[model samples]
Target: MVIDTATTSGDTALKQKVSSLMSTLKSDLCDLVRIRSTAGGATTEAANKVVSLLKEAGVSDATTVKIGSGRAPLVHGTVTGRTGKPTVLLYAHYDVQPAGSWNETEAFTPTEVNGRLRGRGAADDKSGIMMHVGALRAFDKNPPVNLEILIEGEEESGTGSLEEYLAKPENKDRFKADAYVVADTGGIAVGRPALTATLRGIAQADVTVRTLDAPVHSGMYGGPAPDAFMALTRILATLHDDKGDVAVEGLLSKPWTGADHPDETTYRQNAGVRCGVPLIGTGSVAQRLYFKPSINVTGLDGAPPPVHKSLNALQSEATARVSIRLVPGQKPADAVAALRRHIDQHRPWFLPVEVTYAGGGEGFEARTGSTTFAKAQAALQEAYGQAPTTLGQGGSIPLVNLLQARKPDAPVLLWGCEEPAARIHAPGESVHLDELERMTLAQALFLKALSQQ
Candidate 1:
């Protein structure tokens, strides 16, 4: 769809303005990345920094507000536009994941290599914050639509307080909007614009298996005694079939009908799959990733490192943290129950097994076919020179569901700068400069289009 000549000219000018502010955007993003705002870490500092940036970008009322006890601060602000104009809430997270041993550079130390900025939060979400800031700055702080900025601090930590805050009757007016721009998700690939239409929910549990009262000597009891570690592994092995499909019953799944995923070669490269390692599961890649339930043993706490602390003893107890990703139709609680039932039915050797609920959140499926979504697609197409496509993320963003619940009428637009190569939540995380620029421009154009509507 071709934008009118006048709109195209304005978009050209806005694009130039966004280009001019790229340096500032990069600087602000790098500074934000330097904060170690992991789930329970320096999120307050990151939120405050975002508040300061928002104010500098013309959100004069921007300030950090506490949501709940033990939860990170939330940054809130608004830019009032012309009377009768539709409101748009800009959303992104300031918190980041902990830096594991995978980063090429210090997770807190932002580095610019080639055309990418490398840091922990640089891609996952810190860039999302900067994208909103850049788009507002492009409009010189006076956007065409009424703008509300909600930069979250605990999104990576399960968004505990925001849920309660939004549920209050008095807070409804604060978030009333015609559209919600959730900049926490990303495109399908660099320079390929895409909107995330669905997100998988998460259900996790800590399963403990106790085989004996205490550790026993391997040589003395190896023949007759059951090992807790072995029993735990056996229980986990039942989660998948021979083809790697989830073996758990009662979990909901359906075929994906969105844009096709990247070819196997590209997907393997993007996912950093080891050479010769086959991609597991059946059906289309998109279906496996976005429409089906998958289980993973995220952490184990029974066996010592064999290479460093090998012991000639059998463990008495073993515990594993299992994470299950759920599709849109499934409830988190129901999924957890199904998982428990599966483990109970598959326990080996009658070992004593206990399951403890970890945390979980429901998935989201955006309401498409709205005027706001259409404008967003047009804006992306204009910015990238290609039509935008729809995609679904396997990861969970709890706040998306909460915000949707609060404002069911508002169309939620999920797009960002973290493409496949950005490596979000993994080592060597980075965001392409071009992707950031295009997204910022697209956001600015989208808001302008909304104002005209």
Candidate 2:
């Protein structure tokens, strides 16, 4: 990654301006993080807060658009630029994942420690919102290119509200742009700059197993009666072979040709892998994560807590939510079908089994050969003192595919401040201050370069 030193005087001034706004950025980010805007929770306050911030940043038309009667609101706004300059659509999500039991810090309370902001959504997406806000403020909300801001409130939920809204013919023209910047992804490390060039899609299913009509005493049926919980465990065990790779047939995968993943020690530290537990699967970390199908039992029910709530009985039924991450070129429907078939074939004791489809979306591969991509690389190089590397994200953003399909020619850039250490969707989520500042400057520089083109 070679560093470029061809920054113009204006670029230098912009960098200085962004630096001066760091305190404000941190303050604003903390304010946003203070709001408990978890998906399906009350998010109207968060939406209004974003609209107010955008308006204060010089986007006077910023407001929240209701998606449906009960769905979360979408924050939309635009800043007009000089005629002949291209339009750039900026995207980020304000909704956050639920804070589970693992958080070291309070999930909604914003805390700053060692130059990082700690809270739920601080790095996953709320920081993404701040990235756009800080950049627009650096330019006094008048960017070099025409700007269309569409901040979603249901990205973490995977409800497809934004996708359905954008699909409408009446609303298509408002989102059309020469370039799109999705600020929901991030680099590989704290100082390393990366643009997510590909993203794995998601497919999910609910698997239920039934053996008997009702529970029976374990003392009487322990040896012969089929236990639905035990049966469910056996069925789930078949999802992965001995090597821990997905055993489902007809799913697609390919060799990873992008930037290499972190080494084992760093990867373990980032993932918080328990010590002495060997990593499952074959091939390199990037290959396993970016270019292959993986399955996880995300939820399970019908079994009581083993410690105090356990019953010594043969359970009649059990159910689990299975989540599958599909590689590029794999259809969500096909993956779900394959998963259902695999579940049916693996049922033990000729038990009754059911598999039902859940929601999912297709993966995305960016058009990285475009001039906009080059500008993004140069901008990141200028911001981080090294040329950016392209990487693939293991997560899915269904909206990215919709945008790409809507405007096939426009390049969609995915970059953000959330590095591996951020622990997004987990406890102790945080965003490094320096990474936030650099990402903001990079976005500002990319917009300036696009205006020049």
- For model 1, what is the error of residue 72's alpha carbon versus the real structure, in angstroms, after optimal superposition? 1.8
Model 1 weakest lDDT span, ten residues long? 1-10
**Candidate 1 C-alpha lDDT tens digits along 3-51:** 3323567888998999999999999989998999987788888888999
The residue ranges of model 2 lying beyond 4 angstroms of the native Cα positions read 1-5, 102-105, 168-174
lDDT of 2 by residue, 1-453 (tens): 333349899999999999999999999899998888887675888999999999999889999998854378999999885799998889999999888885534898898899889999899898899899988988976787888899989988878888887778887765888899999888889889999999999998889987888999999888788888999999999999999888999888899988777667878899899999999988889889899999998888887467777788898889999999999878888998998887778778777899988888888999988888988999999999987789998989888888876678999999999899899998899999999999999999998999888
> By lDDT, who's the top model here?
2
Q: Identify the leading candidate in terms of TM-score.
A: 2
After superposing candidate 1, which stretches have Cα over 4 Å from the reference?
A: 1-7, 103-105, 168-174
